[model samples]
Structures are given as C-alpha cells and as structure tokens.
Target: MKHISIIVPEGQSNLGTVACIVGAYEIFTRANDYWKEKGKKQLLTVELAGVSKNTDFHEGLLTVKPHTHISAIGKTHLILIPSLAHDYQTAVEGNQLLLDWMVKQYKEGAEIASMCSGAFMLASAGLLDGKKCSTHWSAADTFRTLFPKVNLQPDKLITDEKGIYTNGGGYSFLNLVLYLVEKYYDRQTAIFCSKIFQIEIDRQSQSAFIIFTGQKQHGDEMVQQAQAYIESNLHEKISVEELSSRFAVGRRNFDRRFIKATGNTPVEYLQRVKMEAAKKAFETTRKTINEVMYEVGYSDVKAFREVFRKITGMSPLEYRGKYNKEAA
Candidate 1:
C-alpha cells in the first residue's frame, strides 16, 4: 500500500490540525478506498513530532507520538508538513532533528507537501532551494527574508513541481489534496471527491494561478487613493469615472494602474472587497445573504451569489450554511 504520512508539529493551530485530519480522511479513507479497489494501494498515516505545547485537540484522535525518528519515516510515499505556528521567526529556527529526518526522507524519494505556514518547515529543511514554492500571502515577506534560496511563488493555491507541493494560505489545503487525487486517480475521481466534500473545483489557468492571492503591493499615490475611495464607499455605487476624478487621473491611466496595483480591475476589486465583507456579515450576523449582499453594494441577489461563488469558491449561502452550522 502507498503510505502517506502526515507530520504535524506541536503547537499547531486547532483549525489547521482539523484541516489535516479532514484531508487524510477525505483523501485516504473516503477517496482512496475506491481507488484501492481499482488496483491501487494507498494508505494514510499521521505522525506528530515536536516539543511545543499540544494545542491541537484533533490530534488526540490520532495515534501520534512525541518524536518521529528516521525508521518511522521510512516507507511513506508522501510526507505532509502541516501548518505550524504563525511566528515565522521561530520557524526559521525550527527543530533540527525534524529537518534532518525530512532531508533523509527526501533523499529516499518521498514526495513533500506543505500547507500554509508548513512551507516554513520545508524551507528550513533546505529542500525548497531554487524550487518554486508558495505560502500564505501574509507570510510571503517573512518566508522570502528567511529562505532567499527558494523561489517563492506567492500567488498559487498550491504549486506542484516534481515531487514537492506547497499550498497557499487558508483552506487551500483541501485544494492541494484534490490535486493529488486528480494526479493519482483521474479528473472524474477528483470531481467526485469534490462533490463528496462539497468543495468547488475551479480549474485554473496559468494566468489565473498568478492572478489570485499573490498580488504585488501598489505604492502609487493614485492607486492607493483609488483603493481608499473604494473601501470608504463600498456601500455606494463606485464608478471608474468617480475613481479617476477622485484620484485626478485620466480614465485610461486609472484602469491600467488599478490592475497593475491590485491585480484586478477596479470593478473586480470592489466586488471582491464586497464579497469579503458580505462573508463576514453572514457569519457574524443573522442577516440573510440578500441583506448582506445589498449592504455590500450588490443590489442583485443572483449577481451577488455569482460573484461570491466566483471569488471564494462557495456561494454566500453555502459559506453561511457551512460556517453558521458549525458555529451553532
């Protein structure tokens, strides 16, 4: 059987730890069972290591140990470094024994995967040198400063090069597992897995991959003004003409600069901002999706639902239903 070992460090976030377990169950047991019967051997084994405090409640359900030696690391086809503490400075000075074990495993041909800040651990292992990797955008600066040898592609939800895969921040961990399913099984199988998990699979192009999550900051005065204008007037109708006049820039210059600054045009950026706000309202308040949509500048329920789904990969109703049910 192909053994996939998920290695979670101590002091991991509760959310991240739960996400790892969900990935294991969804990819290995629920999804791999079908693939195994079809002539493939796949198994998932979770191994935990570290001296930090065990803040992950879900880890109690798994048979994880305090230390994972080289012998235990042997025989796994894939090794996942789950998301770790947000302190990038501490990650730069991570555990040496774990780093050495990872090196040994990589040398023995184990595919390495990292979710979110887990890239910090992989980079510390020196395995990501000269290879394109990604992490949550908030950690992009810290990652770059700490691991200059690694070619960090900040925009990807996940980047798969050779046997190494790294994911961007948030729940893109789910997307990473889905990518693995497609690789091992087929596109149809991946689609089935997505449906089972209620995950929306948005097949992305290269340009689209570069477009989301890793946009460069625009320090231009006009661009910043435009952004401020949009945020201050999110509930109001924001027009390009208003933005151009507010920023004292021509319409053509404003359009080009807006895209250059935030990676999306003014309208797209405004809609994304609105959707983000609407998401927060739906989760934190009892307001309906339609009410939140209108509050965020969207007057049309159909268009509001479409935009939320397009950006977040989930409709406002779906997001609310998922999170609200859990919150309750």
Candidate 2:
C-alpha cells in the first residue's frame, strides 16, 4: 500500500486548511473503500501527520489533532500541504519545524503537493525552486517577489513537475485531488470520486476566475501614476510612447521600470486594466459585446475577442453569459 502523509502544519488551523485536510482524507479513504469493494486490496494508508499534536484556530473555536507526529512517520510516498493562512510570512516562520520535515521527506523520495497558498510553504522549504507552480491569483505578486526563482503561473489551475505538484486558489484544490486520484488509482475511480464530491474534473485554467487588478505595490511613483492613468482613461487609446513622454521618461527606460515595478510590461498592464473594467461592465451592466468593446477603447471586434479570450480563458460572449445572469 502507498503511504500518504497529509501534514497538518502548526499555526495554520483556519477553516480552509481544515476543510482541505479533511476533504483529502475523505477522498482517499473513500477511494480505498471503492477499491476494496471490487475485491481488490487496499491501496493507500492516509494519515494526518504534524509536528504539533494539536493546533487551535479561531481563538480555540476549532482544534485539529493529527494521527501521528512527523517524527514518527518513517517513509511516505506523498506529502500533502493544505492551504495556509494568508499571513504567509508568519505561517512560514511559525512552521519551520514542519517545513524542515517536509524537506527531509522530499529528499527521501516523497512527492509533495501544495494547495492554494500552501505553495508558499513548499517554496519556503526550497522544494519549488526553479519549478513551475500555481497559486491563488491574489497571491501571485507576493509569491513572485518572495520566490523569484520559481516559475509562477497564476492562470494555470494545476502544475505538475518532477515530483512536486501545486494547484490554484480556493476550492480548485478539489480538481487537483481528482487529478491525483486518477494518477494513484485510475480514470474510472477519479471520475467516480468527482461525481460523488460534485467537483468538476480536468479543470486546466483558473484564468476565467481571476480579476486582474494590476500589481501596484512596487512603490514606484511613476508606475503608480501610469496605472492610475490607465484605469482613469479606459475609454481612450493610451499608447506606451505617450505615457513615457507624459511621465518624462524615455520609452525604453519606461518599459524596463514598468516591468520591474509591476511584473508586467507597460502594454500588458494597460490591456489588463482595460480588460478588468470590461469584466466588471459585463457583470453589472447589460452592455452589448460591441458596446463593451468600444467602451474599453478597442475598435476592432476581432482584436478585442482574441485578447479577452487569451486573458480570461473565455470568449466575450461566454464571459458575459457566465457572469451576467440576465444575459443567460
């Protein structure tokens, strides 16, 4: 039987973390039951292993007790890290012992997987260096700044490389669990679990759910001004050349500074700002596709649709239909 240790990290006893831990336990246990019902041997031994015996959350409203301590676990085939609290720095600092155990487990040939912001823990433990990772879109900027060596793909729903795996923001971890089920068991079992859990399987991108509020916390006054200009003048055709001149910076220097400050080129930032506005308009107003397109300063329908689809993983009409209940 394959041994799976789900690390119940200290100082991360929030509701989401608990849900993921319990959810994973249920899924794997149920998968084993399904296997056994078919006259097959039990395939997995899933346990909650942690550095601490118990962790409390919400001022003692909730407490999680692990099945075993990390030190007691000898060798496991997989280690699962649940979503951590949003105070990522504190979460990482407080769980140093757990992180060290995870690193040691990985070194001993254990595959690791992190859910949502749990990627922060994996990255801090040096398990994700120079590897492709996916986290919540809201945490992308912080993750990029903290782990510049890791390739961050916020748009992706899940990432798998070598023996490490990561999945995007909240609830999307269900999809990753289903993916793992398929890998550890078989396609039929994965499909069965997906149906039982009511989780959509094979979801490949979180792009459609991401609200691209451009990264503006880089402390660059000029970049902040540029972002403000883009947001305030979404109806205008703003050019990077014009922005550079208006900001009294050379075009090349402007592009370089913009990328450094915002993790996006000047043009990319403008498009994201415009697209974000268009998304809001689609959600709240009964604007026609062309009306929204023209309002965002895109005169060409083809260009607008292509860019919208590329950034959002959905066509303009599809996005509107999905978000605007009246449109449906």
Candidate 3:
C-alpha cells in the first residue's frame, strides 16, 4: 500500500482544515475500497502526521490528534498539506518544523501537494522555487511579495509539476485531490469520485472567478501613478510612450520599473485594466458583446474576443453567461 501523509501543521487553523483532511482520506480510502470491490488489493495507507507530540486545539476550538509525528515517519509516498488559517506569513512562521520536515520528506522520494493557502508552507520550505504554483487569488499579491522566485499562476485551479502540486483557493482542493486520484489510481475512479461528489471534473483555470483587482502594493510612486492612469483611462487607447512621458520616466527604465514593481509590462497592464473593465461591464450591464468591447476601448471584435479569452479563459458572451445573472 502506498503511504499518504496528511500534514497537520501547527497553527490557529482555518475552518476548512478538518474537512480538507477528512475529505482527502475519504476519497482515497473509498477509491481503495472501490478497487478491492472490483477484485483488486487495497492501494493506500493514510495517516495524519503532526509536527509535534501535542494534540492541536486550533482557535481554542477543534481538537486534532495525530496518528504519528513526522520524526517517526520513515517513508511516505505523498504529503498533503491542508490550508492554514488567516495570515499566510504568520501561519508559516509557526509551522517551521513542519516545513523543514516536508522538504526532507520531499527529497526522500515523496510528492508534495498543498491545498489552497498551504502552498505558502511549501513555498516557505523552498520547494516551490522556480516552479509554477497556484494559490488563492486573494492572496496572490502577498504570495508574490514573499516568494518572488516561485512562479505564481494565480489564474489556475491547479498546478502539477516535478512532484509538487498546488491548487487555487478554498475547498477546491477537492479538484486537486481528484486529479491526483486519476494519476495514482485511474481515470475511471476519478470520474466515479467526481460524480459522487458532484465536482466539476478537469477544471483547469480559476480566471473567470478572479476579479482582476490591479496589484499596486510595491513602493514605486511612478509605477503606482502609471497603474492608476491605466485604470482611469481604460476607455482610451493608452500607450507606453504616453505613460512614460507623462510620468517623466524614460521608456526602457519605465518598462523595467513597471515589471519589477507590478510584475506586468506597460502594455500587458493596460490590456488587463481594459479586460477588467470589460468584465465589470459584462457582469453588471446588459450590453451586447461588441457594445461591452467598445465600452472598454476595443474597436476590433476579433482583437477583443482574443484578449478576453486569453485573460479569462472564456469568450465575451460565455463570460457574461457564466457570471451575469441578468444575462441569463
């Protein structure tokens, strides 16, 4: 049986912590039972491994007991990290031991999977360096600020590469778990579990659900002004040259500073600002696709659709249908 260690990192836990842990156990064990019922051997041995000997009582509430502490764990095939409560920085600091243990286990032939905010822990351990990762869209800015080396794909629902996996926000860890089920078990079992849980199978991107609130946390006054100008003039065709001249910064220097401060180039930032405006139009106004596109300063229909699809993973009408109740 393959060993799966569900990590219970020490912290004032999120409300979903227990549910995420138990839910994974339920799915994997049920999958094993299904395999045996189909006349095969049971496939997994699961355990909740804690960082310390103490039984954890998070938020002065739920009491979580561990099956074994990490020191006792000699071999584990997979390590599952559930979401930590509240602040990512604070939660990670308290779980330093767990992070070190995770890195060690990962080096010893274990694949690591972090659910939601738990990606912060894996990132803290340096396992996420130079790897693509997904996290809660709300925490994307903070995550980027903290771990700039790790490639943050905030628009994705899941990211799996080189044995490290991270998922987007909330209980969507179910989708990540289901994906792992397909890899370790089979597609048949994954589809069966999806049907049983009513999960949307193979959901790859979280972009449609993400509201593009522009990132301006970096301490660059000119870059901040540039961002503000882009947002303010979404209905106008704004150019990099215009922004650089207006801000009194050179073009090459402006591009470098803009990318460093905002993680997006001048043109990409403008496009995003326009797309965000278009999204708001679709979500609120009963405008036609072309009307919305025009409202966001796009004159060409093909250009508008292509950019919208690129940013949102859906076409204009499709986005409207998905999000706009009035459009429905």
TM-score per model over all chains = 0.58, 0.96, 0.95
Residue-level lDDT for 29 in candidate 3: 81
Residues 1-328 of candidate 2: C-alpha lDDT, one tens digit per residue: 8999988888844788988898899998888889898899998899999877788876788888999998888899999999988899999999998888888988989999999999999999888998999999999999989998898999999999999999999988889998999999999899999999999989999999998888877889998998898899999998999999999999999999999888889988888888988999999999899999999999999999988998899998999899999976
Candidate 3: tens digits of C-alpha lDDT, residues 226-302: 88888877778777999999988899999999998987888888888899889998889899998888778889999
State, as a TM-score between 0 and 1, how close model 3 is to the true structure.
Answer: 0.95
User: TM-score rank, highest first?
Assistant: 2, 3, 1
- Candidate 2's TM-score reads 0.96
Per-residue lDDT of 311 in model 2: 89
Predicted structure with the largest TM-score when compared to the true one: 2
Task: Give the runs in model 1 whose Cα sits over 4 Å from its true position.
Answer: 12-14, 36-70, 92-94, 202-328
Model 2 steric clash pairs: none
Provide the global lDDT of candidate 1 against the true structure.
0.69
lDDT of 1 by residue, 1-328 (tens): 5666666554434566557645754564667666667676654444444443343344466434434444554566777777776765464464555667777878888898888788998888788998999887777756776777888766567788879999887677777878877875688778888888877685431212222332335467777766776777768867888778877889998889877666568877787677767767867888877678778887888888887777766767777876677434
